[model samples]
Target: DFRPHDEHYVQNFVLVTHGLLMRIFCMCYFRWTVLEFDQVWNPQNCEIWVLEKTKKGRYRLAGSWQEESKSFGPIKFGADKTKLLYPHMKESTPARDMVPGKPGWLDDPALRHLVVAAQFGKGIGVNKELGSLG
Candidate 1:
């Protein structure tokens, strides 16, 4: 089952995605601002720990997904949160015609197809029984 998405989580993911796209892929020419002003994330339950697989397909801590290739996580918060980083992120070619921008952008139906791409792979686990700082 899918985790119930918190809007806070979704919004911040957009911020990270946009930032990554800008610095790495140059898909956008805009600044870090979500719309007009920047969206300052809250540093509570939003801490993100990136988990990656090795070349041999073994699970390993990737240190950080790296917000625009900058060092700041394994567990990130506030301006660094990024739990949803997934496949093709570095290679995500934003459709020139369908980048996010609308009254209710998160609820946009056209981009719904991107949801699976953002989901954590089946390898990710939670709790001590699985793997977590807790």
Candidate 2:
């Protein structure tokens, strides 16, 4: 059983496979327009949370999963709203990529590898989660 974001509107993802296995991931993006310009910036990130199933058949957040790499750097959830400390965030956060355009998960080699491994282990199809996100 898979719960789509639109249907739940909770800005969360619940993926259940092979009956007993359940994985929860959270992805969110938002944009804001400033002044009279039509231009807007969208930042997005995916959060893989540790979900524990309750006796009542409900899921609860335990914590989040973080991956750190000395070769590359610490994996990020993407440019968050806090990055908007200035009117021109593009200049301030040149290192961070905006979401809906650059998915950090797909861009980072380590993150990509983790996703692929999870998919393979769970017997999930290719880009199934990506399609849902997009």
Candidate 3:
């Protein structure tokens, strides 16, 4: 689980998954929805959705990017510094990754291409399961 709040979020801005190892960054162009924080005591219980548009032009869950993961509120906003919260993200089966042995939906060719190109000297190895990210 990773929650980025600084330059690392800006520079290293791609999700990588190789076998059991998965690193994610929540910075994609998602049609998101927000759930307000109701009570101060229940800070970590709030959630939001990172949505993707379906072929029928409807919104569905892309990933659940948590605003707070471990009791600490990872996202903050507003005038009084209100903590924004979301549920922990889980890998979903996209319509694309439903093919045999593909596993997760983030294994698309275009995204993989970007990951391989961007990860030259970043110490992050490309996926060995499918030969390469691209």
List residue ranges in candidate 1 displaced over 4 A: 1-82, 92-94, 99-110, 113-134
Among these predictions, the greatest lDDT belongs to 3
Over 16-114, each residue of candidate 1 has an lDDT whose tens digit, in order, gives: 444333233221321122211121223333334343435553334343445576664532312235543222222223353433433333343433323
Which parts of model 2 are misplaced by more than 4 Å?
1-44, 68-134
Clashes of each: 0, 0, 1
Task: Give the distance in Å from residue 98's predicted Cα in candidate 3 to where it truly belongs.
Answer: 9.1
Instruction: Extract clashing residue pairs from model 3.
Output: 67-86
Ranking by lDDT: 3, 1, 2
Q: After superposition, how far is residue 120 of candidate 1 from its true place, in Å?
A: 15
TM-score of each: 0.21, 0.19, 0.21
Writing each residue's lDDT as its tens digit, candidate 3 over 35-121 gives 111111221333433445466644443433654563322343222445332332222233332242355433654234323432322
- Candidate 2, after superposition: displacement of residue 78 in Å? 18
